[model samples]
Target: MPEALERTVYVVGPRWHHHAAHADYAVAASLACQLSAQVKKLNSPIEYRWLSRALVRRLLTQSKGEPNYSLGTLLTEIVVARHMWRRGGSLYHLLYGERDRTLARSLPRLFTRPVIATFHSPPARLAHKGIDRRRLRGLEAVLVVAASQRRYFEEQGVTRVFVTMHGVDTQFFHPAPAPAAGPPRCIVVGGHLRDFETLGHTIRLIRERVRGLRTVILGAPTRWQQSLYSAGGGSVEFRYGISDHQLLAAYQASSLALLPYQDATASNALLESMACGLPVVTSDVGGVPEYTGSDGAILCPPRDPEVMAQAAVRVLDDPAYARERRVRGRTRSLQFDFSVAARQLLDVYATVLGDAGMASG
Candidate 1:
């Protein structure tokens, strides 16, 4: 390690430029904060630093409309690499690689150490080709959020694979007393890549069967809102950007959380819902089961709206079952603490650094 003042690790992730605000990609931002804090508390040789997302955005503003538009990410990587090149004693950590898919390939040479990265979704390329290989290269390990992703990475022979489940701030998401007068309700959250088309069908199912149920859909984009406008005859509330406090209220007021994702590799909303003592009913695809475990949340067949709706209704209608689920949900959330994720992540850094040391020696 370099002198104490120079020892550091660099983290690159989504650009949440606001004053530490919680945006759609805030899950990674929060986890980054946790990791940084833990590293500081340990008083190790390395310090944690984040690449300036704002700097990247400002420098590449004209390229915002570029096709696939990864110029900002590319510039960020180059900037960070140059910075680390000058600093000479930092490890590169890609917090999802942001949009720079080729980050790993370039980072290792600059840092003189293997780069570590996490993936939120599968590789975009259907088949690995020229640039795809570099895009997937240079990582010491690729940490995934669930076993399903690990399986995919192993099958494809990617770098080292590890399961790192999503973490939640239990203290921030703890349960509130259920509103005494509100009708039985369920919450729908997540955005962009979610299965809103299927969620529309699920809402219809809920309307047909469950009486006096309120369905609050949070963070539904214009496309989703337009498609789901007539859904449930307006019983379904399509809420566009909501605050964290509002989201917590939605969770605490609900009987269950519904996520009809076409596919997933662990969900931030699922973890948050359970952390707030809300049971969940989501599609059983990808890493849904990994997050739900055996009993915390009910899992239904994907694309089957009726089954998903029925599961939510069952959790809501049966007081005894909901109570059991609440207990299980909170218990499950406890197991996914940030500390657990931090331990595993720090271990990966240690291993990578040790391997680099051995090779150098």
Candidate 2:
């Protein structure tokens, strides 16, 4: 394939907003939009075409292994694969990694060019299970956002792996003027793997120590889920299906960000909150520490309410210390800027395409 002709890169994944309740889809959407903008501004010889929900039909048969899987998804993969196999392309990028066993193996055989899988992750359980490994079999490269994921994939004998940190939109999530003097407020964002039981416990403990501290839970909790927090001592507010503007506003107004997750991989809320210069108290699990850095935020063991509560109080009680953490966090966020990641990703694209002439550039 000519370098010029192979400039278009096809991306396959769930629609970024396909699931309004899931934060991962939002991250997928943000990445697609940002990466496209960055590549265009650089006048790079590449373009990304995304395919997700529209590609697959919602078939009920896949409910057992893939409850979310659809007939459209399966057909689309074959469609894209057959197209690349018959015609020609530089590479096929699977953003959600792999969908199913048969598709993962067949897609590669159907493509003459390299197949690059990115933006994929499963809970530690799913990835380790014998079934999902089928998805990793035929790929030219795998891009991960978390260190733990990279390690996990490598341990499985997969090579040519890369780690890309999640990027933050500083312009959107930047710090704002502190809210009117009142009780300090904290926020819990994102629905994936969040441990609300731990959150309730931590909030109760925090309210006992910190006077007038309030919390806002955005994303994931239905009215029944909201009822689980009956023991709240501090004020607790819940909001669902809010706009990004409203979410960012919550981040800016809050003094601390709480992300007590039960399981693996990345957290979009962690990056957005830290970018907004809010202190974070998150579970010390998976790739979270990769973003939070050693000193940027407070890390506590998962399901431990007492330790998490103490960490929150420490940040809220010490204004000077909290401010320092905020400053450090914002500085760390800049390193993961989309532009830098875009350039690096372009290099990966060039390398995987075997464009020796352009890869060196």
Poorly placed runs, candidate 1 (over 4 Å): 1-7, 14-67, 123-131, 358-361
lDDT at 148, model 2: 76
Model 2 residue 260 CA deviation (Å) reads 1.0
TM-score of 2: 0.81
Tens digits of per-residue lDDT, candidate 1, 1-361, equal: 2112222445666433421133223344345446554222111121213447686567467555433446545556566666666754455667664345556666675466656677667433223222244456667777777777666566555757766666766777878765324687878887735788888888777877778878788877777675575776676777656677877777887777888877777677888888888878887888778878888788888888888878877877788888888889889988876656655666665565555563122
Query: For model 2, what is the alpha-carbon lDDT of residue 3?
Result: 24
lDDT of 1: 0.66
* Residue pairs with backbone overlap in model 1: none
Tens-place lDDT per residue, model 2, 228-346, is 35645526777787777777777888889989988756666887777888888899888778877897678899899999999899999999888888888888777665555554565
- Model 2 worst lDDT run, 10 consecutive residues: 39-48
RMSD of each: 5.9, 5.8
What is the alpha-carbon lDDT of model 2 when measured against the actual structure? Answer: 0.66
* Total clashing pairs in model 2: 4
